[model samples]
Target chain A: MEALVASAIGLLTAVGIYMMLRLRTFPVILGLTFLSYGVNLFLFTSGRLTVNAAPIIGRTEPYADPLPQALVLTAIVISFGMTAVLMIMAIGGHLEAGHDKVNMSDTDDDTPEVQS
Target chain B: MLTAAWLVDVAASAVTGDAVTVKITHWHGLEAAALWMSLAAIGGGLMALGAYPRLRALWDATPRPEAKAIFDGIIEPLAAACRRLTDGVHNASFSRAVTVAVLAIAGAGVWAFSGGTHLAGDRALLPVTPTVLALWAVMVIAALALPFYHRDRVVALVLTGVVGLLIAPLFALFSAPDLALTQISVEVVTILLMLLALNFLPKATPVESAPGRRFGDVAVAGIAGAGIGWLAYAMMTRQPAFDPISHFHLAQSKPGAGGTNAVNTIIVDFRGYDTFGEIIVLGIAALVIFALSETLLRSPTVTRRLGAIAPVREDGDRHPMMLVVATRFLLPMAMMVGVYIYLRGHNLPGGGFVAGLVFAIAYLMQYMASGYVWSHARQRYDHHALIGWGVLVSVLAGVGAWAFGLPFLTSGFEYVNLWPLEEFELATAAIFDLGVFLCVLGAVLLALASLSRLGLRTGEDVNTRAFDINPDAAQAEEVR
Candidate 1:
C-alpha cells in the first residue's frame, strides 16, 4: 500500500513537472495542480501511512499524526488560492500581450513588450 | 665578564637588604658560558648559509605552482559552471527553467539518498483491497492522460477533476475524513474557477515545443517522479526517526483544548496562530485576485479583447428553470448543513474551513442557477466587508483571551446546561472557528465572484429575475 501511494505521488509529480514546462499559461496552471497534489500527499505521508486511525480522540487507540494533517489542510486551501491568482494573471497577461506563450525570446523582436 | 660582575654586585646588594656592593671573581670557566657561546655560533652559521648567493639562486629557480594560480585553477571553472547553470535555468523560458529545476532536485535527492545508510523497516505494510487498487489505477490513468488531452482544455480539466475526486476517497480510506471533506469541496470550487477563466482563455493549447524538446522534458519529468516516489516509499516504510509530537496533541486535545478531534484542536487551538496567519494569507490572496480582476476589467485592451471573444453559452436557456428552482430550494438546507457542520466542528471531522466551503458552494449554486446579475442584486453583504469583519472577529476572539489574562487565542471551554437542551460543551475555539468560517466563506466567494466578473464583459443579457419564466406569469397568460 505504501508502494502504491508512493508511486502515485511520483507519477503525479512527473505529470505536474511535464505540464508545468509547457509553453502555455493554462498547462502551467494544470501542472501546478498536479504538483500540489504530489506535495500534499508527500507531506501527509510524512506522518507515516495509517489506516482507520482518525485523529479524533477516544475513537481509535493510536491516532494518525494530526500535525501533518493540519499542515496539509492549509496547504490544500493555499494552493487553491495560488492557482486562482495564477489563472487570473495568465488571463491578464494574455489579454495585454495578445499571446499566451510562457517565454519571451530576445531574438523574436516583433512581439511587443508587456506593459508594466 | 665585567658586565657579569656588575650584575652579581647588583644581585648581592639586593640580597643583603643594604647598599653593600659585592664583586664576582670566578666568572670564567662556567658551563653556562660555553652553552651560550655554542647557541650563538649555530644561529650565526644558519644566517651565513641563507646569505649564500648559490643557494638563494637555486631556491628562486626551482619551478612550483603559484598559490594564486592554484586557487584560480580550482575556483575559476567552478565559478564559470555556476554562471552557465544560472543562465540556462533563468533564460526567461518557463519550461526550460522548470525542467532544469526538476532535474537538479532529483539529482540532489539521489546524492542525499546514496550518502545515507539504509535499512528495510520492520513495519508491516497494509493489505490493499481490490476497491482501493481500482481507485488507484483510475487515478493514475487519469493523471497520465492529462498531458495528452491537455490541449483540449476542458478534457484536461475533467481529468484533473477525476484525479482530485479520487484523492478524497483515498483520504477517507486512510482515516482523514476532514481532509477528504476539504479535498472534495475544494475540488468543486477549483474546477468552477477554472471553468470561469476558461471562458476567456483559448480553448486548445497550441503545439509549439519541438519533438526533441518534448522528449527531453519527458526524461527529466520521469527522473523527478522516480526520485520523489522512491523517497516517499522509503519514508513510509520506515519508522519515524523520532517520536511524533502528535502524542502531545492527542493527549491534551480533550483536557487542554476541550475537543475530541485533535486535528481540529490543533488548527483552532494548539496551532491557532498558524491558522490565523493562514486565514490572513487566504484573505490577501482573495483580495489580490479581486484587485487584479478589477484592474483587468478597467483596461481598455482587455475589455476590447473580451468583447471580441464569442459568448461561452450562445443559445442555451441561460438559467435553466429546474436548476434555478432546485437550487433555490436547496439553499436554506445547505445553509443549515453548514451551520450544523460549523457547530459540531470541535468534536467532529467538520470544521470552519469545510463548512465555509460548503456555504460558498451553496451560494455558488445560486449564482449558477440564477445569473450573476440576479445574485449580485440580492447579495446583502459586501465581499470586502465580509472579509474585513471576518478578520476582525477572529482578532477579537484572540483578544478575548487577553481579558482572562490568558495568551492570545488561548481557548477556554465549559459544559453549559441551557434550557430545553442537555449539557453541551461551549468553547472559545468555537468562536475562533466562527471567525475562520467567516473568513473562508468570504475569501472563496470573493475569489469566485471576482473571476465571474469577466463573464459580464461578454455582453450576455442581464437577468433581473431569478428565473426567466415565472410560474405566476405563465398561469396568468393561460387564464387570459
Candidate 2:
C-alpha cells in the first residue's frame, strides 16, 4: 500500500510537471493541480499509514496522525482558492494576448498589466 | 530544541501508564527503491528520446492516414455517445472498451511496480492492504492519462474532478473522515469553479508545441515523478529520524483544549496562527480573482474576443425554471446541514472548513439554477463585505484571548446546567470555528461570484449599466 501511494504521488507529479511545461495555460493549470495533489499525499504519508485507527477520542485503536491531516485540510482549501485565481488569470491572459500560451516573450509588450 | 524536549517531557509526564514505543532502525530497502526509481526514470527518458524519431515521423506522415484513422475511430463512438446522452436522461452509457483499457493499463503498472517494491529488510511500518494498493494504482494511472485523454477544456475539467474523487476515498480508507469530508467538498467547489471558468476559455486545446519539445517535457516530468516517488516510499517505509510531534497533540487535545477531535483542536487551538494565515491567504486570493474579473469585463480587447467566440444562446435554455424551483427548496436544507456540521465540529467529523464549503456550494447552486441577474437581485449582499467581515471575526476571536491574559486563540470552556437538559458545554473554539466557517464560505463564494460575472453575457438581460463611455472616465470611476 505504501509503495502504491508513493507511485501514485510520483505519477501525479510527473504528469503535472509535463502538463505544466505545455505551451497552453489550461494544461499548465492542471499541472499545478497535479503537483498540489502529490504534495498533499506526500505530507499525508509522513504520518505512518494505519487502518481503522481512531481519528477522535474514546476509541480502543491508536489514532492516525492528526497533525498532517489538519495541515492537508488547510492545504486543500487554500489550493482550491488558488486554482480559482489561476483559472481566472488563464482566461484573462487568453483574452489579452489572443492565445492561451504561457511563457510570453518579454519583447512582446502588448500585454496590459492589471492596475488596481 | 530544548523547548521541544521540555514539551515532550511535559506530555510524557501527563500521560500515565503505557510507555511510548520508539523504533530506531536503518531502512536498507530505501536504497534499493531509490535505485529502482532512478533507473526507471532514466530508462523512460532514454526510451522517449529513442522513440522521438519514429513518433515525429508518424506525426508528420503524408496525408496523416494512421493518425486520422485513429482520431476518427475515437470521435465517431464519442459523438454517438454524446448524441445518445442528449436524447434521453436514461440513455447515458460509458464505452466498455475504454473502461477495459483504463483497468488493463492501471493493473499492469501496479503489478510491475509491486514486484520491484518488495525488497527485503525495508518494509512500511503498517502492513499493506490489497484494497488500498489497488486504489493507489488506479489513481496513479488516472493522473498519468489525464493530459492525453482530454484536449477539450470541459472534458479535462471533468476528468480533474474524477481524479479528486479517486483521492477522497483514499483519505476515508485511511481513517481520516475530516480530511475526506474536506476533500470531497473542496473537489466539488473546484470543479464548479472550473466549469464556470470554462465559459471564458477556448473549447479545445490546439496542437501547438513541436513533437521534439513535447518529448523533452516528458523526460523532465519522468525524472521528477520518479524522484518524488522514491522519496515518499523511502520516508513512509522507515522510522522517523526525529520524534513525531503527533503524540504531543494526541495527549494535549482532550485535557488541554476540551476537544475530542485532535485535528480540529490543532487547527482551532494549537495551530490557530497557521489557520489565521491560511484564511488571510484565501481572502487575498479571492480579492485578486475579483479584481481580475473586473479588469476582464472592462477591457475592450477581451470584450471583442468574447464577441467572436462566445456561445450563442437559444430561448428558455438560459435558466431552466425547474432547476430554479428545485434550488429554492434545496437552499434552506443545505444551509441547515452546514450549520449542523459547524455546531458539532469539535466532537465530530464535520468542521468549519467543510461547513463553509457546504454553505458556499448551496449559495452557488442558487446562482447556477436562477441565473446571476435573478439571484443577485434577490440576495443583495456584497461578497466583498462577507469576506472582509469573516476575516475580521476570526482575527477578533484570536485577539479576544489576549484580553483574558491568555495566548492567542487559547480556547476557554465551561460546563453549565440548562433547563430541561444535562450539563451543556460551551468553548471558545466554537467561536473560532465560526470565524473559520465564515471566512471559507465568503472566500469561495466571492471567487465563484467573480467568475460568474463572465457568464452573465449569455443571460437574457444584456448589461447596459456602464457608467462611463470613455476609457479614462472608467479608470477614474474605478479609482473612486
Candidate 3:
C-alpha cells in the first residue's frame, strides 16, 4: 500500500508539472491542480498510513494521526482558493492580452494584437 | 481535563489583569505577548488608515505632465527594445534548446538517484498487496496519460475527477472518513466549477508549443515524480524519527474536548486558529473571484469574447421543466441533510467543512436548475452578506473564548438534563462549527454565484438555461 501510494504521488506530480509547463493558461492551471493533489497526498503520508484503525477514540485501538488530516484539510481548502485565484488571473490575462498563450512573443508588429 | 482547566484559568487571570497563580513558564508569557501584539496591531491599523487617504489624494490630484511624458518616452522604447531582444533570443530553433534542457535535467536526476545514500539499508518488511498495487498502477497510468492526451479540456477535467475519486477511497481505507467525505464533495464542486469555467473557454488547447518545449516539460515532470515517489517509499517503510503530536490530540479529544472525532476536535477546539485562517483564506479567495468576474464582465474586450462564446441557444425555453421540478423536490431534503451533517459533525464522520459544502451544493443545484434570473426574482440573499456574516460569526466565536479569560477557541461543554428529554451534551465547539459551516457554505455559493452573474451579464438574450439535457427536443416542440 505504501509503495503504491508513493508511486501514485510521483506520477501525479510529474503529470502536474508537465501540464503546467504547457504553453496555454488552462493547461497550466490544470497542472497546478494536479500538483496540489500530489503534494496533499505526500503530506498525508507523513502521518504514517494505518489501515482500518481507530479514527476517533473508543477502546484502546491505534488511531491514524489526526494532525496531518487537519493539515491536509487546510491545504485542500487553501488550494481550492488558490486555484480560483489562478483561474481568474488566467481569464483576466486572456481578456487583456487576447489568446490564452502564457508566453508572449517579443514584437507586437509581427502578429497584430487581435481582440476575440 | 485538569490541564485544560489550568490553561483556561491562566488565560482568564491574564485577561482580568490579575497575577496568575500558575508557575511562570514560556507558555504563560504568551498572555503578555498577546496583549502587546494586539496593542501594536491597533496602532499600525490606525496609522495606516489615517495616512492612506491623504497619500492617495496627493498622488491622484497632482500629476506632472512633462515628467509623465518624459517617463513614458524613456520607458516605452526601452520596454519594446527589451522585448525584441528576448524575442530574438527565443526565436532560435526552440526544439534544439528544449532537447538540451531535457537531457541536462534527466542527467541530473539520474546522478542524484545513483548517489543517494538515504535509502541504502532500508527495505519493506512485507510486500504490498496486489489489489492496492493494481489500483495504484491504474492511477499512475491515468495520471501520466492525462496531460499528454489533454487536447480537450473536458477530458482532462474528467480525468482529474477520476484521480480524485480514486484517492478519496485511499483516504477511506486509511481510516480517515472525514477526509474521504470532504475530498469527495470538494472533488464534485471542483469538477463543477471547472465545467462552468470551460463553458466560456475554448473547447481545446491551441497547439502552439514547440515539440522541444513539450519534451522539456516531460523531463522536468519525470524528475519531480521520481523524486517524490522515492521519498514516499522511504518514509512509509521507516518509523517516524520523533514522537507524533497526534498522540496528544487522540488522547485528549474525548476527555478534554468531549468529542470522539479527534480531527473535528482538533479543527474546532484544539487548533482552531488554523481553521480560522483557513476560513479567512477561503472567504478572501471567493471575494477576489467575485471582484475579478465583475471587473471582467464590465471590460469591453472580455465582453466581446464572452459574446462570441455564448453557448448555442437551441431552444427558447431557458429552464427545462424536468430539472426545475426535480430540484424543487430535492432542495429542502438536501438542506436538511446539510443541517444534520453539521449537527452530528462533532462525534461523527461529518463536520462543518463537508456540511457547508453539502449546503452550497444544494443551493447551487437550484441556480443550475432554475437559472440565476429565476432564483434572483423569487429569492434574493446577498452572497456578499452571507460570506461576511460567516466570517464574523467565526471570529466572534474565537473572541468569545477570550471573554472568559480562556485561550481563543477553548470550547467548554456542559451536559444538560431537560424536562422531557434525556440529558444531552452541549459544547461550544458546536457554535464554532456553526461559524465554519456558514463560512464554507457562503464562500462556495458566493464564488459560484459571481460566475453565474457574469453569465447573465453577457448582453445576449439567451436566458441562462437551467440544465437542458436535450435542447433539440425543446427546439422541436417550439417549432411544432
Candidate 4:
C-alpha cells in the first residue's frame, strides 16, 4: 500500500515537472497544481501511513499524526492562494506580452509586444 | 636570568598568596648566573647570523608556493564555473530553469539517500484492498495522460481535476477526514478559478518544444519522480526517527483545548499563530489577484487583446431555469450545512477551513446559476472588508485571552446548560475558528470574483434577473 501511494506521488510529480517545463503559462500553472498535490501527499506521509486511525480523541487508539494533518490542511489552502496568484500573473503576462509563452526573450517576435 | 627570577617570584607568591613583590636580586643564585650566560650566547649567535649577507639572501629567495597565488588558482576557475552554470541554468526560459531545479533537487535527494544508513523498517505494511488499487490505477493513469493531452487545455485540466478528486478519497481511506474535506472543497474552488482564467487564455497550448527536447524533459521528470517516490516509500515503511509529538497533542487535545478533534485543536489552538499567519497570507494573495485583475482591465492594450479574441458562446441557456431554481433552494441548505459544520467542528472532522469553503461554494453556485451581473448586484458584503474583519476578529479573540492573564489564543471553554437546550460547550477557540472561517470565505470569494471580472470584460450580455426567462412574465400575460 505504501508502495502504491508512493508510486502515485511519483507519477504526479513527474507529470507536474513535465508540464512545468512547457513553454506556456497555463501548463506551468497546471504543473504547479500537480506539484502541490505531490508535495502535500509527501508531507502527509511523513507521519507514516496509517488506516482507520482518525485523530479524534476517544474515537480510536494510537491515532494518526494530527500534526502532519494540520500542516497539510493549511498547506492545501495556501497552495490555492499560490495558484490563484500564479493564474492572475499568467493572465497579466499574456495580456502585456500579447502572447502566453512563458519565456519572453527580446529576440522572439512571434507576436507584437504591446508596451504596458 | 629574568626567567629564573620570575620563577622564584611565582614560588614566593604561591606560598604567600600576595602580589609578586619578591625582588630578583634577593632570589639571585648560581642558577641565575647560568641562565644569563645562556641568553647572552643565543643573542650573540643571532647577531652573527644577521651579518651574513649570503644566508639572508638565500632565505629571502627560498622557493615556496605563494599562498595568495595558490588560492586564486584554485578559486578562479570555480568562480567562473559557478557563473557559467548560473547563467546556463537560469537563462530567460522559465521552463529550463525549472527543469534544472527539478534535476538538482532529485540529485540532492539521491546524494542524501546514499549517505544515510538504510534499513527496511520492522513495521508491518498495511494490506491494500482491490478498491484502493483501482483508485490508484485510475489516478496514475490520469496523471500520466495529462501531459499527452496537455495541448488540449480543457482535457488536461479535467485530467488534473481527476487526480485531485482521487486524492480526497485516498485521504479519507488514510484516516484524514478533515484533509479529505479540505481537499475536495479546495479542488472545486481551484478548478473553478482555473476555468474562469481559462476564458481569457488560449484554449489550446501551442507545441513549441522539439521532440528531442521533450524526450529529454521526460527523462528528467522520470528521474525526479522515481527519486521522490522511492524516498516516500522508504520513509513511510520505517518507524519515525524519533517518537512523534502527536501523542502529546492527542493527550492534551480534550483537556487543554476543549475539543474532541485533535486535528482541529492542533490547527486552531496549538498552532493558531501559524494559522493566523496563513490566513493573512491568503488575504494578501486574494488582494494581489484582485489588484492584478483591476490593473489588467484598465490597460488599453490588454483590453484590445481581449477584444481581438472572439468570445466562445455555447448554444445553451445562459442561466438554465432548472439549475437556477435548484441552486436557489440549495443555497440556504448549503449555508445551513456550513453553519452546522462550523459549530460541530470542535468535536468532528469539520472545521473553519472546510466550512468556509462550503460557504464559498454555496455562493459560487449562485454565481454559476445566475450570471455575474445578477450575482454581483445581490452581493452586499465587501470581500475586502470581510478579510479585514476576519483578521480583526481573530486578533480580538487572541487578545481576549490576555484579559484572563493567559497567553494569546489561550482558549477557555465552559459547558453551558441553557434553558430549552441540552448542555453544550462554548469555547474561545470557536471564536478563533470564526476568524479563520471569515478569512477563508472572503479570500476564496474575493479571488473568484476578481477572476470573474475578466469574464465581464469579454463582452458577454449581462443579465439583470436571476433566470433568462422570468416565470412571472407568463402570469402577467394572463392578467393582461
TM-score of chain B only, all predictions? 0.81, 0.68, 0.71, 0.82
Candidate 1 per-residue C-alpha lDDT over B38-116 given as tens digits, one digit per residue, 9 for 90 to 100: 8899999999787889877888999987999999998999999999988776667777677767878888889888998
Residue range A36-102, candidate 2, lDDT tens digits: 8888888988886777884698775589889999999999999998899999999898878777667
Q: Give the per-residue lDDT digits (tens) of candidate 3, residues B38-140.
A: 8899999999889998989998999657888899999999999999887666754433443455457657866885797554425344456666676687777
The i-RMS of every model, in angstroms, reads: 0.8, 7.9, 3.2, 0.9
Q: Pick the candidate with the highest TM-score.
A: 4
Q: Give all TM-scores, in the order shown.
A: 0.84, 0.74, 0.77, 0.85
lDDT of 2 by residue, B238-259 (tens): 7766678888888888888888
Ranking by DockQ: 4, 1, 3, 2
Error of 1 at B262 (Å): 0.6
lDDT of model number 3: 0.79
What candidate 3 gets wrong by more than 4 Å, as runs, is A108-112, B1-131, B313-319, B459-480
Return the top candidate by DockQ. Answer: 4
The fnat of each candidate, in order, is 0.82, 0.78, 0.66, 0.88
What is the model-wide C-alpha lDDT for candidate 4? 0.90
Per-residue error (Å), model 3, residue B188: 0.8
Give lDDT tens digits, candidate 4, residues A28-86: 99999999999999999998888999999998597999999999999999999999999
